[model samples]
Target: MTEYVALLRGVNVGGVTVRSADLKALFAESGFADARTYLASGNVRFSADGEGRALKTDLERALAERFGYDAWIVLVTLAEMRAALDAFPFDASDEARQPYVVFCADPAVREELLASAEPSDEDPIAPGPGVVYWTPPKGSSVDTAFAKQLAKPRWKAVTTTRNLRTVAKICA
Candidate 1:
């Protein structure tokens, strides 16, 4: 069984809420082993053996059926998750910045993000294997230029982001 993480997008926000326990239960019920949710934000770690696309489809379908919401998740193997953590290129220790990893379900989307933004002290973005590592200033991530680009509706279907701190906890 390979370990996997399902980084659910837009959960616990925008009138959608799923209890952590329920999220874990949904994964286990879907036939994953040791399904554990790191926080109420929908980081579910589990063990299963399947191709990535199949797993993603099954998980998303299960989530939608069980929770009655249009669910989306960035499915990653444990190694991929670790690689994203190790490839973080920003000063995560900076008290004034918020570190984030944006998982791109499509490689094209990742490239587009890299090409769309110019690095700055306020919004620095770097490309990783299948992700975009970002460190936008604390309390201002919502206002950053790169952030505004992400807010566009077109990116919603192919991207989901997680705070690096939360990601570390999930990996831990």
Candidate 2:
């Protein structure tokens, strides 16, 4: 069985919720083994033998049926996760700043996205497959022009923002 991380979008945010234990049970019911949730924002780690794409679709369908809401699931294998972590452009030691990994479902060219924005301190960098890294500028800075632009496309993607501590904890 391959270990995979399932990033779920638009679930359990704000006041809307799904209990982690229940979510784990749901995954177990769907034939996943060793299902565990990391953090409260719908990141699940599990092992399964199916193709990632197929598993994504299945999990989406299962969540919708079980919870009465549509869920966008992005599946990443352990190897892919490691690659994403390795590809982070900024040094993880910089805890004073935020680090984000935006996972694009389609292999969209980084140049295309970067060209859409003017380079600034907050500019995002894509170092390798399926990942974009960004560090936001200071206080109440609504300078996430890249994120705003990306959101407009309705692309099959999800952004997970984590500090170096969380990343280390997850990988460890």
Candidate 3:
């Protein structure tokens, strides 16, 4: 079985509450093995044997059926997740900035986001393999243009962002 990390979006917020135990149980019921929840923010690590997108679709369907919400996720293999963590281009040590890896499920949507959000000196958005690297000023992430754009409903289905530290924590 291939290990994968399912980065679920918009959970434990906006009235949607999915507990870690319930998430793990659902993964177990769905035939995934060694499932573990990283945090309350919907990051799940599990093992399964299937193609990436197909597995993601099945997981999303299962999630919606069980949790009763419009489920969205960016599923990546453990190797891919580790590579993304190692390839983080920004200074994660900077307390003044917040480093983020925005995982985009669709290439077209990723291109559209890059086209729309103009990156500046302080707030830079760089494209990586199947992800976008963004480092916005600390405490101003929600106020940045790229962050605001990501918060739009149009991108919700195609993208999800996690902090660099959080990503490393899970990989660890």
Q: Give the best candidate by lDDT.
A: 3
TM-score of 1: 0.96
Q: What's the CA error at residue 139 for candidate 3, in Å?
A: 0.7
Query: What number of clashing residue pairs does each candidate have, in the order they appear?
Result: 0, 0, 0
| Per-residue alpha-carbon lDDT of candidate 1 for residues 1-172, written as tens digits (9 for 90 to 100) | 8999998989999989999988888887788999888878889989999898899998889989998999888888888988999889888899988899999887898998788877786688889989999888889878989999888887886789999988888888
Q: Write the per-residue lDDT of candidate 2 for residues 89-161, one digit (tens) a residue.
A: 8765664556666655545544455555554665545545665666654342244676566565354344444
- Name the weakest run of 10 consecutive residues (lDDT summed) in model 2: 155-164
RMSD of every candidate to native, in Å, equals 1.1, 2.6, 1.0
Q: Is candidate 1 or candidate 2 better by lDDT?
A: 1
Candidate 1 deviant stretches above 4 angstroms? none
Worst 10 residues of 1 by lDDT: 113-122
Instruction: Give the candidates in order of lDDT, highest first.
Output: 3, 1, 2
Q: Candidate 2 versus the native: TM-score?
A: 0.83
List clashing residue pairs in candidate 3: none
